[model samples]
Target: MAQMARSPRQLGTLIQNARLNRDLTQQALASMVGTGQKTVSRIEAGHPGTKLDTLFGILAALDLDLQLGPRNKGEPDLTEIF
Candidate 1:
């Protein structure tokens, strides 16, 4: 399923959910992406300073794709999915 993330927080929530769905811990994901668990935690918490490479690495590890499109007006909150 595709999700619309209007902000870093929303994007982080989606990443967190995907990680949980795969039954992978933050540390496990960090290791897979050659980073520290703290970094993973930060990313999951929507740290605005997250680098593009790191984000892409995490997405790849989670087998996720990032697509860009015209933003929808008044889109529902991403958290509503849970």
Candidate 2:
């Protein structure tokens, strides 16, 4: 099955769902991460101005981690290069 690409809104929705599933309010999460409720709300609304640190804080607060990897396949043999 092909994985569907998620937009910012979709990503935000996923985060929001997780937050709600954990019975957390925006204010609660914000307080946990030492940020303002408005920051959390804006992030949940897919605002582009959300800082990377803020997002990381929220993710950490929610016990989440972000992973990044190559999207395409490419492998090289060292012997072949030499």
Give the whole-model CA lDDT for all candidates, comma-separated: 0.90, 0.75
Query: Could you tell me the C-alpha RMSD of candidate 1 in Å?
Result: 4.1
- Model 1 per-residue lDDT tens digits across residues 1-82: 7987777878999999999999999999999999999999988888899989999999999999999997566766556544
The alpha-carbon lDDT assigned to residue 56 of candidate 1 equals: 99
Q: Which one is best on lDDT?
A: 1
Candidate 2 whole-model C-alpha lDDT, 0 to 1: 0.75
lDDT of 1 at 23: 100
Structure candidate 2, residue pairs in collision? none
**Clash pairs for candidate 1:** none
- What are the RMSDs of all candidates, in order? 4.1, 9.3
